[model samples]
Target: MGDGATTTEAGPESAGVGAGLTRAHWWILLAAALGWMFDAMDQRLFILARSPAIRDLAAGADPSALPALAGWATALFIAGWATGGLVFGLIGDRYGRVRTMALTILMYSVFTGLSGLARSWPEFAAYRFLCGMGIGGEYAAGVALVAEAMPARFRPIALGMVQAASSIGAMLGSALSLLVGPQSRVGGWEGWRILFFFGVIPSVLLVLLRFRVPEPDRWLRARDEARRDPKPGRELGDVRAIFADPVLRRRSLIGMTLGMVGQIGLWSIGLYTPELVRDVVFREHRRELAVEADSLDDLARAWATETGGDADSKLSEWKAEADRHVGRGTLLQDVGSLLGAPFCTWIAIRFGRRKAFATAYAMSMASVWLVFGGMSRGVDALWMLPLLGFCTCGIFGVIVVYLPELYPTRLRTTGMGFCYNMARYLTAAAPVLLGRLAAGAGGYSRAAIIMSFIYVLGLAVVPFAHETRGEPLPD
Candidate 1:
């Protein structure tokens, strides 16, 4: 192994971080972090865009059926995400993380822009799935690059901060949605479509990644050795190798379980929060809108009966007003995310990774139920969403830092990608189930609470987790 790829060794984190990093080190961190930030922005944009885009694309469809339709689209997106994570991770391991990351940015940008032109639900879902490919690939490559590039003394800090930067990206997404709201438009384009178009702008960042960033010295060395001895191809993202080794296989199972809990909870829950808030606000605006109301058609009817106005125009106005508050709720979640990620990182640094995972999962489980069960007011979300965000998102800091520590340089991205994305195949079903449950007496809130139970599995898996604190990266 090269100096860049030291085997796990016990050591204390040093205060020499400022002295340890050079100009290039900072550049690597910033570049990887910003790419991840923009990726987060794309995720948030989809959350905000899903309902409106589905409404437009699924024209003449029953309003009550839109949630299930959107759920299916989201399922496709996660499916794409998992596939891309697996494939691009191999590419990163065999080729170069820098190039793979840059290529992913280009892929997502083009696809997301194309999503804006989707005229039907299937077209929109297809575009989102393709866009998810780019979005999903960026994580393993970015984390692997940063983990390899940084020295052990500051690797955790760098990884945690990189994960932390994503909250800022989420905030930017929320702010953009706030500015655009529901009724705004550009050249007759819906605000949701315009938001998808903004996905192209981040492709410019590819220049920095492509021109300035270099392959980690660790990966370069690994590639040289793999070329010399091509047998046992585990050195190049072989899926079987992760399963062939008993220790690695066990670690992979634990890691995959932990990753799935977060994936299922976050994707299913975040999908509906803004809409949940919109419903709450709309109901508050009109007393006649019942708690059991399952669709916007109820609001349309209420406006027509009570306000004696054009139902279509009134529905639009209500959505616009409620959307403003929804943006705030989303922003608060990001704010909590900003703080929680670092907090969990600090816990991992102090305690063990298992304990950190335990804390995050328990809190996440509680908050998920809180948000979905009787969290009916936007004002309540001011506090609830942040609590939810802190619990649900904080574990990412541990995830970003710890997964790379589990595998050697050659298999780092590949292992992390598999652990994180493979479980997404199971998670793809969660939204569909939630959608079905949502159409029942319990509605979105009840279904989301049911889905949140997946977090309990996170807690269950923690006992088997390997503690990686103060350990150097594996060779």
Candidate 2:
């Protein structure tokens, strides 16, 4: 690869001395981190809510058919992600990062809230696709802003931290799932709907971003320079520019492939933890549910005749038990993710970007195999969930740190967004493909095991990766 096409190796101290990271830099990181955090939370909320929403929508349909419908919904969401990433990435480069960030946040938040109003599966899927577009745009904008703003020494660490913040969003989503549970009713409405209604929380960040954050100096300078001496295929935010040259095209292909590997693993495998929890761990609660059902029937007469206190108490008790037994598996996985995300930063700092990515990919493959192949008990999942999260989710830290390094400032957002979000097109098929595999193979676990080989492609890409550790962003 041409040197300018990718990050060149730099010594630890080569980040070199300048004015150092400023107050503006810190503010930018915070803004980017918050945007990414809320974006991730929105995604996690969908993951937790998808099955329940579909189950409710298809109440009268065959139970076995729910997975297929859910898969279709996921595909639609992924398609939206791909579309938003491509379109907004160009906008980010040509317009500005902060403005695009605000627009995307609004788009996603409004759509997510609207998803709660979806009375049918098709309606829900449409809302989710729109939400996915907003979610998809935020990543490239936030990461590009932070990458360009921070000092070189702090760039990787800041990018990792920004990526790490996404785990907090996922954790919050898990907490929301736990708080509401699928069966809980509020104002006679299902908890899943309420959870989506709350998806508007991220929209609140728009004020902070618009009022507090400023566009990066690098982007401003590059924008001015591009206008002054524009060249063919070198226009700001032009998607065609990314593929106009051999070096950029090669880097773009590798970067997108790397992103696809992680996206496939996450959307296809990691997001299914809730399903496993429901099917495997929650199965043990069947007897408890049966007992509660019998008790509820007896209490119904008492509720009609008496003051109804006893029936209310019994219902509350059952709801608590059900909430405790359900979603625990997915929540535990979130805790694991919290730990894993930061670990990626430490790994990238200690080793290099390539090593960190390779390690994460290898561990993800193995951990996934162990989780799907042998995990039959809830207790086993407690320990294994963290390992699975650490590997699968940690690799993203490397991606945010590494991808922008592959492009110059004028094309940074466009290239990074295309590489990351365009992969969604391939990954968008993950749910459908896995659904078929699960049905044909007779189980989710078996299909997951077969899917685990996708990580090997990540490992193959490692040798060709452009090492960005301690290096400045390409100028």
Local distance difference test, each candidate = 0.82, 0.79
lDDT of 2 by residue, 1-475 (tens): 1111112224463345233666667778888898888888888888888887998887887666777788889999999998889889999999999899999999999999999889998889999999988988888888888878776666777887888888888888878877887667778998889888888988888888877788887788788888899988768998888888788999999999999999999988888776665554433433433333222335434443554466656555644554554456566777777777678767877788789889889889988998888766555666776678877888887787789889998999899888988899999998898877866785678888888899999999989977766666787
lDDT of predicted model 2:
0.79
Candidate 2 similarity to native, TM-score: 0.89
TM-score quality measure for candidate 1: 0.94
RMSD of each: 2.4, 5.6
For candidate 1, list the clashing residue pairs, or say none: none
Per-residue C-alpha lDDT of model 1 across residues 1-475, encoded as one tens digit per residue: 2323231233576556544566667778888999889888888888888888888888899877987998898899898888889999999998888889999989988998999899988888989898888988998999999898887778888999999999998899889888887446767889998888888988998889866776777888788888888887546877778888888898988888888888887888854788678767766755555434445566687657866878888777777777787788889999999899899988887787888889888888888888878786668878888878888898897888789989988888889989988988878888887788787745677788878878877887898899988777887
Please give the clash total of every predicted structure, in order: 0, 0
Which whole-number lDDT from 0 to 100 does residue 207 have in model 2? 88
Top-scoring candidate (lDDT): 1
State which candidate has the highest TM-score: 1
